[model samples]
Every structure is written in structure tokens, then in C-alpha cells.
Target: MEPHVWPLYGLRITTPRLELRLPDLDTLSDLAAVAAAGVHDEDEMPFSVPWTDGTPGERGRSTFQHLLGTVAAWTPGAWTLSLAVRSEGEVVGRQDVGANDFAVTREAVTGSWLGQTYQGRGIGTEMRAAVLHLAFEGLGARYVTSAAMTDNARSLRVSEKLGYHPDGLEVLSVRGEARTFRRLRLDRAGWEAHRTVPVELHGLEPTLALFGL
Candidate 1:
């Protein structure tokens, strides 16, 4: 818990209603359970990776393994901050903020998933605002980017509320079909303009170098 080796474990991003942090083992297990319970309608795949298209047990295991893999695979040039999203003291989902060559590009990407039960409560926007705060305000990032399946209206709406503009579209093969994704981008100006939620960054100073800042 002290994060003596990987200082990133100490970083925290908080909004008025949510806390996002690297999960300890017990917290990670709870997060895995959230995934097992489901993040989207079974009939629709919101993610490009189709990572949730398996048995509940498999989904849980994959969630656990993917977070571990992010930690194991991290480097200064490329890294993912896979944080568990907790609201009212309960694990509700995961939020990831990551980048490659951040020192040079000053850009990052965001991704997330909330348990099916937790969606549509505005938690998604607040949770994302927390990380956008960390990226632009805490880390001096110039821009942030994200993408969602074109049909994912909720996600696109969240992005729009956060001041992200349509960057373009990309077609990707998903679930054996060609799916289009609406790419979104936000710059420092846009992030500052749409900042609604109050976000606090904790224990990030020690992890700046790890982000290549």
C-alpha cells in the first residue's frame, strides 16, 4: 500500500462524487467483480477490443489480468494509469488515462467502463473530469483524445459535455463486423472552458517522471 516500488500506486484523482486510484489487491478483486457483473448490454459491444465477450468468470479474470499487465508493461514512454472508480465507498468501475511519448506529444488518451448498474447517473462525466484534471492541470498535458463506437450515444454525449470535439472517424473490425468509431479530442482551452466538476489530485508529484513529464 505504501507504493515503495511503483510510485504511481500512490496517485489519486478525485471528483466531488468519485475517487479514482490504483487499486490494491482487495479493491482490484472488487473491480473484477464489477466487470463480471457486466458493463454493457450483452447484445451490444461498446468497446473496440470486445474484451467483455466471454463468460462472467472469464470477464472477471481478464479484468484482473489486464490491470496487472498494465503495471508490468509500463515504461516512461508508454503507460496506462488503470484506476478503480469508487463512489460512496464502493467500487463501481475503472478509468484509464494513458499516453505514449507524453513528454514529446503532451497528449493522452482516456478509456473507462462502469458496471451496468452504475451507468446513466452522471458519474461517468465526473470520473472523466477527474482524470482530465490530472492530465491537463496536474500534468501540463496539451491535449487529450478518446474514441467511442458511433452508436454509443452515452459516451459521445459525455465527451461532448467535457468539450471534446469530433476529430474524425475510424473503422475497426469488431465482433466480426466493421464498426465505426467517432474520435474525439480536447485541448487545454476546451478542458478549461468546460470544467464543471471540482477535481483534486493527490500524490501525483512523485509520479510525474513516470509519466515522462
Candidate 2:
């Protein structure tokens, strides 16, 4: 079946140097290429899913399929907005903001990755801030959460910079072994109190219900 298009077409979040948007086919392909070029080394797994564990082509294909699947599986109670991040008009990475039963929970989750070439340039932080702006400001979310392997310091730092507090920890088996992760949470008040980026969101009202809001 063809995926349902979000009611909020051209929904955009922009910072001074970057733009984040739900991508069309052309842009999605660009995003796939970014994944193929490498976000991290094959021997190193930064995500819980090990989505990048295969060959380079497989990694790219998985990214493309996952983004498309989110659109195909969208519903009022759950949704995933896998947005392409553009810098100076070129696709640089992906940023995702999503919710499960948002109306009842008023919560969402954020995830992202930047091309290795783009790391250390503040793009990850900026992109994350853009999504936080959308979650709390545009969608009226009360809380946001995320998780990372305990050893992933860079990710933990980003969460800290954005005002998320360490909520707790969990142990989940991955790749045939037990892995411990740190869970983080940020309430709206905390987000507003620590926000430092200036972000503008467009075309969100019509898509609010897609997140069960």
C-alpha cells in the first residue's frame, strides 16, 4: 500500500544554518547515500538495533526502508517523523521525533545521526534542538525521552546540553549479549528553561492529530 502523506506537507523546522523536513523520494535517496557513506564504523555499534551491522549497501537500504515504513505505518496513536537534515541546501543527516499515544502521555522521543564527516560541527545539537522545539512548542508535548548506551558519551552530552536528566537505566540483550543503557527524560518546563536555540516551525497544526494530540 502507498504510504499516507502527512497532512502537514512541507512542514519545516529551521535554524540559522540548517533546515529539517520530512523528505520526499529524491531527498530520501540523498539521505540513504549519507547513511551508505558511513555514520560510524561497521565494527562499532552506536544504536541499540544494530541497524548498521550489515554491509554499507545494506545499511543504506535499511535506512531508506525504515523511513518509508514509518510513513506507511503512521496512525493517530503513533507516528515517526524521520526528517532529512539539510545544511547549506545539502542533505547531511537525519533527525527523528516520534510519539506513542501522545494524547494520553504527552511525551515523545528523539533520535538522530550525522554523517561522520559532519560530526563535531554542532549539527547534531542544532538538529536535536529543532525537534525539541517542535515537540514542546508545536505539539504541546509535556515530556521527551531518549536512551543511549552508557558508554556513548557524545550522545549523553547532547542530552545533558538539552536539559534532559538521567531518568534511570535498563539492561536489554542485543547481538546476543546483555547491554546496559541510560534513559533520559526532559519535561517541557525543563526544556524551556534551558533552551538556547532559536527555531521556527511551519505546517504543524494539520499533523498534530497524527501524533494523537
Candidate 3:
């Protein structure tokens, strides 16, 4: 019998020290454990959505469910490629590259989180570069966008380093409190010119249509 494969079964994005790919059940469980350990400190909430606001076990369960939902709800016009980020063959975090109305917009959004233990290193930047490569080169995306809380200097800096231009701001309610977020965007030319990491993608042909490419 043939091995069960997902729409993006064998897709992968690799950097010098990291690998990003769709997580299988076992890998997803490992990813959940990492998330359960925690991402940010208890007092802080970096994401607009408080997905990690619950208990550690709850966070892990939520991570697992969210990833599964993305796959089950996928459509040609909308998709969320939630790839597990691994370092040295161990699940460390998650990097999500997503799109809406991609067939018409040709635009994508990127979001990610690293385990607290992995925060200060340059891993976040490198992982993002891999996804950017997959977006513009592998998926033929025309533009990519991202957002960071106004206070999230690390995230904003990563976007700046990748040549994403400031696209103004938006206010959103986070945990019942209103907060300002800085929006950023990068075009194909800008991404190509600023991209430095050499990324390799494997087995994306069968899933290209699912992303409306």
C-alpha cells in the first residue's frame, strides 16, 4: 500500500540550520509539546489572538487542533500552510504561511512563533527567510505581508531585515484591550533583492493548485 500523503505531503523548506515542513501526526504531537512549554511570558501576549492564553496542556491541544483544522478546511482560494519548524531534527516551533483569495490577489501573509528557549537566536529570521523563498519563488507569489504588534521590536526588526516596507498600522482588540499593530509588505522584486538565505523546496507540485498558484 502507498503511504498516506497530504496535499502538500512532501513539501519542505530548509535553511542552513532549520527545516520547515507540514507535520505528520507524530511530528505534530512533538510540536504540541514544544508549544505547551510556552512561547512568551505569562504577562505578555505578542499575538493578536490569545491562542496561548490558556494552560500549557490547553495550548498544546489548541495547537494540534488548529493545524488539523487548516488541513481539513483547505480550499483552492484560501489556505494556511502551517509547517513545523525543526532544528537538528527536533520540532521547535511553527511557521505559518497563508493566503486568502490567492488566485486573484497573489498575496500571502506570514506568521510564526519560536519556543521561549529559542527566542534570542537568529533562528526566527532564518525560518522566515525560508518561507519567504517558498512564497515568492516556489509559489510564484507577487507580494507578501506581515504584521507585528507595535511593541514587538524583534518581529519588526526581522521584517525590516527582509526588506519589508512599512504599510501603516491597524488597531485591533487583543485580550479585550485595544492595541496598535504595524503592517509590513514586500513585493517580489524587494524580496528577491533582499533574500540572502539559500532555500530548497521539495515536493510542492501536487499542492501548488491547492494554493491557487
Candidate 4:
């Protein structure tokens, strides 16, 4: 898949144990399969959107379409960069960095999910560190934000490990029930202070304009 027409496809961000890139068609299928295999316990809903509550096939198809939709709906003023997270050359999950009016606001938000089999190994922290590097270093972003359910200790731990601080809380209707979520934020100073992972960016230069850089 040549990226001559879509340079974002060429952008890549790598950490010690993971590689993050926009998936081509073939890799997208593998990523969709990872979603089909499952990300969290059925009784638990970590995401506000219940896209994963569907059947196995539905989960996979939804994952596939969501990534495609990100590409289709992208604009200079608002965009979602959904990168497929690969470890040991296999797709393990996805890491997303998104923003609106990034050039002026200089803020980006992140969201992600890892396969159930890949959790609890610190991969979550490492993958996020990789994207924070892109957001702050590669794209000159001043702040990055994330949110997770208040009970989602794993996700909150990951954010804390990466230097994010509590911003606020939100009450949302998840699956028709009230859910409490914690908002977190990290500025450039905090990101620089907590930098530990050695991340490498490739092909980001060409995609900078698309991010309104």
C-alpha cells in the first residue's frame, strides 16, 4: 500500500517492544481479528460506547469499519489517528491520538484498547508513551488528555505512569446506566519530565501537514 496519496499511511511510531502505524488492508484484518478475540471481560465495559458488546463477528467488523471511518472522516481541523499496535510483528491492539484545531489549541486526546491476552505486561504504558512522543515531540502539541471509567484502575495506572494528572470527572450513560469517568491531562512539561521510553518516529514529517502542523 503506497502512501503517495495518503501520507499518513506511511507514518510510524515505535517503542522498545511495539510498533504503531496505520494499518493497511491486510494488517487491518489482523487488527480486527484481535478485537474479535476480545479486549475485556464480557461483564465489564471499559468503553463508553458498547461496540464490543456485539458477537465475535460483529466486534471484528465494527473494529474494521471504525478504523476505516477515521480515515474517511479526517480533516485538517479535526482528525483521529488510529494506529494499529504491533508487538513481535503481530497486531496486539490499537493506540489512538486525536484532536480538533490542534494547530491553534495544541491539545490532543488519546484512547486505546489492548487484547485481553496482552494486558498486564506494561505494554499499555509503553504504547502510550510512544504516542505521547509523537504528540508532544513530533507534532509540537502542548497538552494531551485521556479519560477512563473511574473504576478502570488499569487504564488510570497507565496514565499516571506516563505523567498525566487528574483533570475532572464526568457522568455518562453507558449501556443505559450512569457511569463515572475520570478525565486526565498531561502538558509538555509533565511529558518531558516523565519520559522514559525511547521512541522512534518514522515518516512523520510528511504527515505533519495533515495534522495541521
Q: Return the top candidate by lDDT.
A: 4
Name the candidate, 1 or 3, with the larger lDDT value: 1
Q: Give the TM-score of candidate 3.
A: 0.96
* Residue 127 in candidate 4, Cα distance off native in Å: 0.7
Candidate 2 Cα errors over 4 Å, as ranges: 1-5
Task: Compute each candidate's TM-score over C-alphas.
Answer: 0.99, 0.95, 0.96, 0.99
lDDT ranking, high to low: 4, 1, 3, 2
What lDDT would candidate 4 get against the real structure? 0.95
Q: What C-alpha lDDT values do all the predictions have? A: 0.94, 0.89, 0.91, 0.95
Give one digit per residue, the lDDT tens place, for model 4 in 90-175. Answer: 89999999999999999999999999999988989999999999999999999999999999999999999899999999999999
Give the per-residue lDDT of model 1 (tens digit) for 1-213.
777788988888888799999999999999999999998988999999999999999999999999999999999999999999999999999999999999999999999999999998999999999999999999899999999999999999999999999999999999999999999999999999999999999999999889887
> In model 3, where do residues sit more than 4 Å from their true spots?
1-5
Lowest summed lDDT across 10 adjacent residues in model 1 is found at 1-10
Q: How far in Å is the alpha carbon of 197 misplaced in model 4?
A: 0.4
Candidate 1 Cα lDDT to native: 0.94
> Which residues of candidate 4, in runs, are more than 4 Å off?
none
Ranking by TM-score: 4, 1, 3, 2
Clashing pairs in 1: none
Error of 1 at 171 (Å): 0.4
Tens digits of per-residue lDDT for model 2 on 1-213? Answer: 122455644588999999998888888889999999999866777788888777779988998999999988988888888999999999999999888888898899999999998998989999999999999999888999999999989999999999999999999888878889999999988899889989999877776667776
Candidate 2 residue 189 Cα shift, in angstroms, is: 1.6
